[model samples]
Target: MKKLILALAVLVSLSAAAQRSQDKKKMDAFITNLMKKMTIEEKIGQLNLVTPGGGIATGAVVSSNVEAKIKEGKVGGLFGVHGPEKVRQAQDFAVKQTRMKIPLLFGSDVIHGYKTIFPIPLGLSASWDMALIERSARIAALESTANGLNWNFSPMVDIARDPRWGRVAEGAGEDPYLGSQIARAMVRGYQGDDMTKPTTMMACVKHFILYGAAEAGRDYNTTDMSRIKMFNEYLPPYKAAIDAGVGSVMSSFNDIDAVPATGNKWVLTDLLRGRWGFDGFVVSDYTSVNEMIAHGMGDLQAVSALALKAGLDMDMVGEGFLTTLPKSLKEGKVTEKEIDQSCRRILEAKYKLGLFDDPYRYIDTSRPAKEILTADTRKAAREIAARSFVLLKNNNQVLPLKKSGTIALVGPLANNKNNMLGTWAVSGDPQTSIPLLEGMKNVAGNGVNIIYAKGANITNDTLLAKKVNVFGTRIDIDKRSPEEMLKEAVEAARKADVVVAAVGEASEMSGESSSRSDITLPESQKKLVRALVQTGKPVVLVMMSGRPLALEEENELTTAMLQTWHAGSEAGNAIADVLFGDYNPSGKLTATFPRNVGQVPIYYSQRTTGRPATSEEFKKFQSNYLDVPNSPLFPFGYGLSYTTFSYGDVKLNKNSMKPNEAITATVTLTNTGKYDGEEVVQLYIRDVVCSITRPVKELKGFQKVFLKAGESKEVSFKITAEDLKFYNSELNYVAEPGDFKVFIGTSSQEVKEADFKLQ
Candidate 1:
């Protein structure tokens, strides 16, 4: 029996290997045959990515004379074009008019969700439900593919600590472990183990290296960090995506070690292709190759050659590759073999997408009717949105608003649908969105009286409002003055039994090119909220924004506060669910909320300084702030729940464990409050002493569980030496034997400590 089993296993392995060899041979033969018929211009054209003029213009690089270029065999791929009809029109031009007859690849920036928008990526991370986050990506793929897009620039897994960076809205928040988990889930949801499926679009893991750790929380700024920091902190999520079989990668706009990522050979070649074994092609961020000229790399032509040698295969929305690669080859600056290699990668992606099988595979005009924004998709969005809403404060249990009350919904966001879908939901329809006023009415039914007022514009500053409107119509200035709007808002609050103040950024206030030095609430909203609080009615603030807004003042005056991050198409319904107790909020803060902008880069995982800021007796010369506290307004992983939970002392199975052995830590948690709720029980580890200084605490494991009011459940986590591993100064990932501290609790800030040792 053993001999027969071994024989069968060997046969199966051989068969799999043979099948892979056959597939590779077939792919190589096809690409070789096609390249033989192509001229240098046609091959170079295959590497160019151009955006069609005027379809969903998110970026500034809409290609000029796009139709003429496609016909001339000067264009490779097209993005910013939507609808099956438009995509088909461009594909037909390429296949019928170009000499090579190569089908054009259609791409879109379908981040977060498509037409059936879900919460922004940061908001989604708060849920900490991997399955739910993956489902959001799945739905996005379904909608985007139905609309004729074969490639999606999505799953931006940049691990950002600086909330002031507007692009944080596009990523999973800090903590590489959590970001890596979310990254894997998103890749699985998108690529789905098969890129050939019509519902599964190819996933592109973006911003190649550390685009998240920008200097001073500035967008597109240079990022400089030690090799150990990259391996241990910011680079894990991108590696996770690659491990999950992500199909493509996008280069970041920022430079690392003073070398632009788009033109950095060490980043694109040695590390990504050599160490990580990433086989996917790298596409430059929008015009990044050309932008390298401004980085003092060289002229446009020189930078283009540098990018090609650096291993960037696609020039996203830049004609740099199209016009310069051929010139560089003629001048002997670049070789034809390099051009052919990149062209082959482009062709390979198309083949895997089944575009070669049928040029119109994703362009079925009928699919949109059945697949886009269906009832089930909207339902999923609502559930996920509700799960994403972090209950920041529920003081006095002011939330779970009673259905019988005459409620006043005040603020510019109260009745606005334009801002509901948030940023980068390019295909989302504002008309289809249900506003908060409608949501309250839908949740409360006919018995409740709901009054609403446009308390203030998203921001009353004229220049700021105009700048924000560059993205969308987020601000609608009333003919009435700010004072008049405040008067009406106060009057509405006075008459109501309770006030639900809808406040925060417009959709454009926290996306790309929208960084804010001062992340505090707009002064106009602050005034309106203070007036409402003076009304003596319990005010519930529904704060909607992408990044965490500093709400120190609102946190004090408001009886309850909810952080609803631009909850997508079903924004109103989901917020209504949490407000009416239909859904118990379990979302935790993935990013820290600073007390002020001065603490912009604050996060939980900081190395222990010589003078640590503890709550012991104050030391004047310690690392303490003179004006504000060193602590954030709310720490990372902090969130409130309607129900209270009691945690028992952490119990460890052993006092020590060998390098290869494991230790089990257990905590007994009871729902001590009145209602049943979900809790995200967190586990943090601290290396007491190490060769290098470690963080004060680092989140290692977490479990999301549900418990009835009085039910107690013991949650156990098995920790091994592998969990203690970190990249040393020598750039080697190692686990040093040492004493360790284990903490288990609801959040990073609140935990029960236990001591253990690594033998």
Candidate 2:
């Protein structure tokens, strides 16, 4: 009976494979036929992606006369235009008014969430929950497709170690293994099993190459790294996204090895398509193709030709392809075959979307009310926000405040609605967001008496405020003096039994071009916190920022600290839930919190030095800073729950294993403290000997488990030689037979170790 069942399953799998092969052949034929009917001008048009001036433009350029271009068959796709009605109007021009009647592909930057917003990508990574992350993407897809958007430029899986880059808020932090896992989840959630479904949208894994490791922690700066380092440390997440079948890729603005990503043939063709086997069409980042000219590549015609040859199929918000491709083709710099290939790729995408059959399928006017921002979606957002918050400190058990306490909520963000939704939330409405003060009132009701005061502005610097307020009035300068605001806050703190100070960066402080040299809290908020801390009342600091902040002083001064990365739409409700003990925080830090800005680009997986700094004290002739400790304020995978967990010594199933054989590492985890909670059991592996130097410890696996008070459970992780593989000097992914050390515990810094070997 078992053999019969196995045989049946094998037959079903073969049948599915055969069906997929046939479908691919059919899709190819359809695209080939469509390409034959298209004119040379129309083919080039299909490669051009433009945006109308409707939504937020990340760059300065927005296409003019968009309606005429669509009607004249000069435009292929559009972004920044959403809503079923508006999208239908644009689609009508392409399908109903154009000669060939090709449907337009609508894309949007649905980064973290759609209408019902969730936490930023960095905060979502802190949860370390693949299911929750995937669910968030799924919700974003559902809401976006309902609004007639078919493509999402999301799942920014760039591994960022530098918080000063600002774009770190938009990605999974540091570790390639963890970043790769998140990349897969996000792709699965956005695309699902079928692309033809109306509920699913194509996912574009973005910033194609390393845009995160910008020099001087500046946005769009040059990135230079060795190929081995690229493969082992930075390339996994992008590879994982492609392996998960993400439909599109966006080239970054930065250059790699002196060649801009948008025009690098070795990167786009040789590495991505040849080595990794990524079949998706690549799209240029906003005006990235044009920016290559500034990178000293060449003239517009020269760069545009280079990009098309480099496997970039779409030009986003740049008319480089539309304007220069024809001349380049005529001048023999580019061939018609190359143009046809790009045209074919775009047409294939439309066919996969079932656009050829029904161009207006996603334009149902009734979907917005039924699918967008429903009660169920908002509830999910609230729950997910609570889980993303990390408890950095809780001295004397200051958190989980009593419902009957007289609480003072004072800070710039406490009652503000403009900054609730973090950066790149293009579709979310800030006016609909619930403020911290309002959320506390709703949750605490009559049991808690909550007093509110405007402690200080988000920042006192007018120049910085103006730069941040480009999108909106994010950091509003109050007419009242800073001293007056501080005085009001101190008075409120004195009257209350406990104080909850809401402070941190404004929404625009850590995204896109918002990089900062100094990553500490603004002096205005720092002074506000200092005053509140001196009131002799237990102060619970609810810190909100998009990236890991330099919080050494704040952590030392505050009674309790919650690192909430601009929890979106339901942020207020979620913060209230955690503060009142309605939910226990299960989030762990994805990025290391630096003690100071001097320790920029700090991460747990640093290569072992000849003379390593083993302690906080600086040693002469060692790799240590004299003024400050080498340690971070909080290490990666570090978060404190309301309850406590203890791990027993690691027990191995075997001492040695072959390349194919698996070894099991087991540890008994107990909820030692008095509350039920979830703990992320992290597993790190160290290569005792290698041809090339490796990191002291690399994250291999992790498991999040829930345990009741005093309950003990045996947790196990299976390891094979595959888990030990790394890119060597030759850029070959291989695992050497040698001794290995395994550490299993709560975070990177705190763990228990055992030994193993590969034969």
Candidate maximizing TM-score: 2
lDDT of 2 by residue, 457-516 (tens): 999999999999999899999999999999999999999999999999999999999999
* Residue 716 lDDT in candidate 1: 98
How far is each candidate from the true structure, as Cα RMSD in Å?
2.5, 2.0
**Any runs in candidate 1 off by more than 4 Å, and if so which?**
1-18, 55-64, 616-618
TM-score to true structure, per model: 0.96, 0.98
Candidate 2 overall Cα lDDT vs. reference? 0.92
After superposition, candidate 2 runs with Cα above 4 Å error: 54-64
Give the clashing residue pairs of candidate 2, or none: none
lDDT of candidate 1 over 172-267, digit per residue (tens): 998899999999999999889788898898889988889999998888989999888888889999999999989899999999999999999999
